[model samples]
Target chain A: LAKTTQPISMDSYEGQEVNITCSHNNIATNDYITWYQQFPSQGPRFIIQGYKTKVTNEVASLFIPADRKSSTLSLPRVSLSDTAVYYCLVFSGNTPLVFGKGTRLSVIA
Target chain B: DAMVIQNPRYQVTQFGKPVTLSCSQTLNHNVMYWYQQKSSQAPKLLFHYYDKDFNNEADTPDNFQSRRPNTSFCFLDIRSPGLGDAAMYLCATSRATGGYGYTFGSGTRLTVV
Candidate 1:
């Protein structure tokens, strides 16, 4: 399992775009980068995933550089409801995932 | 809405007493996982069931055990609860191995008194 590093916390205002970056320096060839959003007392929900390049969805966009050492999750028009912890996971095939301490994003209205 | 479900959103148990948390999923996924999350910490993998086969994490305490009688349902059993066992227990399911983000239940907050 590759260890991922993210900011401890972040602050953003409503209607603003918030981008949380994650670093996974030891990412492997078969490793896939995925992100999840977890609200207080709730399970983490899948946000977006990518092998390389950029992928966009209704909720967020994932951008991965060619090196694949890191990725970013971009949330558009943030709202107070979006305040939650965001996790970045690096998993190769058939391996159990290690959930690192994620970035806690607080959206202020 | 075929989703993951965890029962008794909150549970209170006395120290050294055994407690069980239930998880059921309508998605019928092949994999089920249990995670323990303490206050202000990341969710730690306790164990998971892959088609009736149980796998426990290396650091998971002996007190933590799991049973998967069949697909779509799994249980986390803490043999003897300690004060440190009080935390949120989360249940999730996925079709693939850790690549796809699994569906998570709201979690059961266990309080050991």
Candidate 2:
């Protein structure tokens, strides 16, 4: 399992674009970068995942550099309901997930 | 919609008593996972079952045990509940490992008296 480092918390205003970056300096070649969002009193929900390059979905976009050592989650036009804790995880095939403290995003009106 | 279902959203157990938490899934996934999350803390993986094969985490306590009778049902048994055991237990299922498209239940909040 690879360790990830992200901000403890971040604050943004409504309609602003938010980018949360995660660094996994020792990421393995087989590992994939995944992101999850968790709200109050609920289980973590799958956000986006990518092995390399950029992957866009209906909810968010994942950008992975060529080095694969770091990735960024881009949330466009944030809203008050977007407030939640975001987790970045790195895992290979057939392995359990390891979660960190995660980055808490607070969206203010 | 296919989803993961957990029974008894809130559970209250007495100290030193044994309790079991049940999880069922309609997704028919091959892997099921149990996680314990305390207040203001990250969800910690306790163990998982990959089609009847059990995989327990290295740091998980001995008192925590799990049983997967079949593909649709899995159970978490706490032999001796203590005050520290009170937390939210989340059940999740995935088609396979690598954490792909995991569907998690609403979770069962356990309280120890």
Candidate 3:
């Protein structure tokens, strides 16, 4: 397990793009960068994950640099419903994952 | 499809009383995990069971115990509920697919009164 650092909070207007970056300088070689979204009264949801380079899904995109020291979660065309606390975690292939304080994204209308 | 389901979304237990939280999953994942989250805080992993092998976190209190009777169901038992234990308990399941696409339940909100 590796410790991750992310912004405390971020705000964006609806239909805008929101980018939340996380830094894990001590990230292990086998560690993968993963992001999760947690809404009010609900469990954290898996948003996106990537080992290296860039990975895109229908929901979001995970961008990893060559160093893998940091990663960014890009949410396009944000909506009010997309507002939530986003977590960035680092974990090996088989181990219990840890959740950090995470960056809270507020998509305002 | 309700991949992961937790029973009694809201639970109220008296101080020092024992309570059990139940979780079931339809994904047929080999790994089941339990997490505790306080209000407006990040979730903390308490433990996980991978194919019936119980693995608890180093700092998790002994008061909190978990049992996995079968493949699809797991239980978290609190021997003595305290006010500090009031929070959301989330149950999540994942396969050994070498990814973090773990499916989580809605979570059980435990209120200690």
Candidate 4:
């Protein structure tokens, strides 16, 4: 499994755009970058996933470079409820999804 | 809705006692995973069952065990609950093909006292 690295914490104001980046230098050829949001006492919720370039969903957007070594999760117009730990996982069918020390995004008022 | 469900959202067990956490999924996914999450820590994979085949993580302790009966139900058995074992136990399901992310249950908060 590919190991992922992310910021320990980030602070963002409400209505601002927050971008959290993850680095997976050893990503595999078939790996996909997927991001998840986890609130207090709740399971991680899928935000967005992408293999390359970009992928957007109703909740967030994922941008991956051509090398696929890094990916970014962009949350637009954040609110206080968006404050949570965000995890970036790199995995394929053959590998289990392993979580790193996620980025705790705090959406400040 | 078709989703992963964990029973007894909260559980309190005596120290050295045994406790079981249950998870059921309606999605009919081929993979079922168990994870343990402590305070302010990332979720740690305990084990998983792909169909009837059970896979255990190399680092998982002997105190932790899991059983999957049929396709919809899976159980986590903690042989001896210690104070350190008090944490949130999360159950998730995913398809064998990957791409799609795992669907997680709300998690069962276990308190060992």
TM-score of chain B in each prediction: 0.97, 0.99, 0.96, 0.97
* Candidate 4 per-residue C-alpha lDDT over A37-105 given as tens digits, one digit per residue, 9 for 90 to 100: 899999998888889999998899999999999999999999999999999999886666788899999
What's the true lDDT of residue B54 in model 2? 96
Question: Residues B29-109, candidate 3, lDDT per residue (tens digit)?
Answer: 999999999998898889999988999999999999999999999999999999999999999999963448888899999
Kept native contacts, as fractions per model, are 0.90, 0.80, 0.63, 0.57
Q: For this target, which candidate reaches the highest TM-score against the unseen true structure?
A: 2
lDDT winner: 2
Tens digits of per-residue lDDT, candidate 4, B1-101, equal: 89999999999999999999999999999999999999999999999898999999999999999999889999999999999999999999998736367
TM-score of chain A of each: 0.97, 0.99, 0.98, 0.97
Query: Candidate 2, residues A13-87: lDDT per residue as tens digits?
Result: 999999999999999999999999999888899999999999999999999999999999999999999999999
How would you class the docking of model 3? medium
**For model 1, how does the per-residue alpha-carbon lDDT over B1-113 read when each residue is reduced to its tens digit?**
99999998999999999999999999989999999999999999998888877888889999999999889789899999999999999998998666586889999999999
**Model 3 per-residue lDDT tens digits across residues A1-109:** 6789999999999999999999999999998888999999999899888999999999999999999999999999999999899999898988767888999999888
Q: Where is model 4 more than 4 Å wrong at Cα?
A: B97-99
Task: Evaluate candidate 4 and give its CAPRI docking class based on DockQ.
Answer: medium
- Name the 10 consecutive residues with the lowest summed lDDT in model 4 chain B: B93-102
Q: Every model's Cα RMSD, please?
A: 0.8, 0.7, 1.1, 1.0
Residue pairs with clashing backbones, model 1: none
Evaluate model 1: give its lDDT: 0.92
Best by DockQ: 2
lDDT of 1 at B41: 95
